[model samples]
Target: MNRAVAHPQQDGQDRPGPTTRLSVNIGEATAQVLQKHKARGISITETVRRACAVYDLIESEAAKGSKIQIVDRDGTTRELLLIP
Candidate 1:
């Protein structure tokens, strides 16, 4: 589920720069979501990174006493407060 690996050379690595490692755990359901993003022509890395960035934004807002507002398909609203 998680492993440390170096960046691929084919991914525009002209020179061997600093080797940074990133580990991620993608469960079955999360993998399905990643596949859906791939279906839309998005790379797995990009999709995960974007999701992480969004989560970071939400966490930042929550730390400032903000609630995550969710609007359902039936026009019902829900608020989520994440505590760390």
Candidate 2:
């Protein structure tokens, strides 16, 4: 089993924890968004981490009986689905 081991501290500074490598296929548009986030000073790993966090939050809310919807400025609302 692959394990995530913490990185050794250096220069007396606390750095980001070590993480296991994960391979995912994010399509072209998502890839562009990831790159954009990276360009804005966010690491690729961090970008992915934030995206995963958002998904986790959405799932948690949905499981709690919350209706997930995407609303547009024109007042159009569409229900979002999370498939396990």
Candidate 3:
């Protein structure tokens, strides 16, 4: 399940827009991943935000026929397929 709540400004400061709080339900594997990130001192919200940004970039690049790759310390290269 997913839920979103809009929060209004409180400090009477002029800003861009309202902030929306999001809640989501995840499986055990995903929860474990979040726990790992938490152990690394990363908050769950930051992790999700970064993940969304990365996913957006990958999707945009893939749409342009770009291939993602990973290079190892031994100078080995391999393609990473996240979409399709």
Candidate 4:
């Protein structure tokens, strides 16, 4: 077996910094969405935050089955096929 080095044998100054990580390669359609957001004077960070919130909401909804009752209000039971 062989070992691999995770970092250089140099001081921390040789390591990459945080700003190098804050960049991403967004596609054309994603750029269009960002541009529309910019028209509303929103920063990229805000856009990403909003997107994450919406994603969480959608996933939660899909995970939770609706509480609606298909049976009549006369105390009847109904068969439900949950997409589990």
lDDT string, candidate 1, 1-84, tens digits: 332233333453325686455787868998999999999987877676566656777787778776678779998999977756
TM-score of candidate 1 against the unseen true structure: 0.64
- For candidate 3, write residues 19-42 as lDDT tens digits: 568788899999999989989987
Root-mean-square deviation of each candidate, in angstroms?
9.9, 9.9, 10.0, 16.4
Report how far off residue 37 is in candidate 4 (Å).
0.7
Candidate 3: list runs displaced more than 4 Å. 1-15
- lDDT tens per residue, model 2, 7-58: 4233322356654777888799999998898899877777666666577677
Judging by TM-score, tell me the better candidate of 1 and 4.
1
Each model's TM-score? 0.64, 0.59, 0.73, 0.48
| Model 3, residue 71: C-alpha shift (Å) | 1.0
Clashing pairs in 2: none
lDDT of each: 0.69, 0.70, 0.70, 0.57
- Candidate 2, residue 4: CA error in Å? 29
Runs in model 2 lying further than 4 Å from the true structure:
1-30
Q: Candidate 4's C-alpha lDDT?
A: 0.57
Q: Candidate 3, residue 67: CA error in Å? A: 1.0
Which pairs of residues have clashing backbones in candidate 4? none
Please give the lDDT score for candidate 1: 0.69
Rank all candidate structures by their TM-score, best first, as comma-separated numbers. 3, 1, 2, 4
Tens-digit lDDT track for model 4 on 1-84?
A: 332223322232323664232578999999999989979987666676567655555455546753323466897976544454
Highest-scoring model, TM-score: 3
* Candidate 3 local distance difference test against the native: 0.70
Error of 1 at 15 (Å): 18
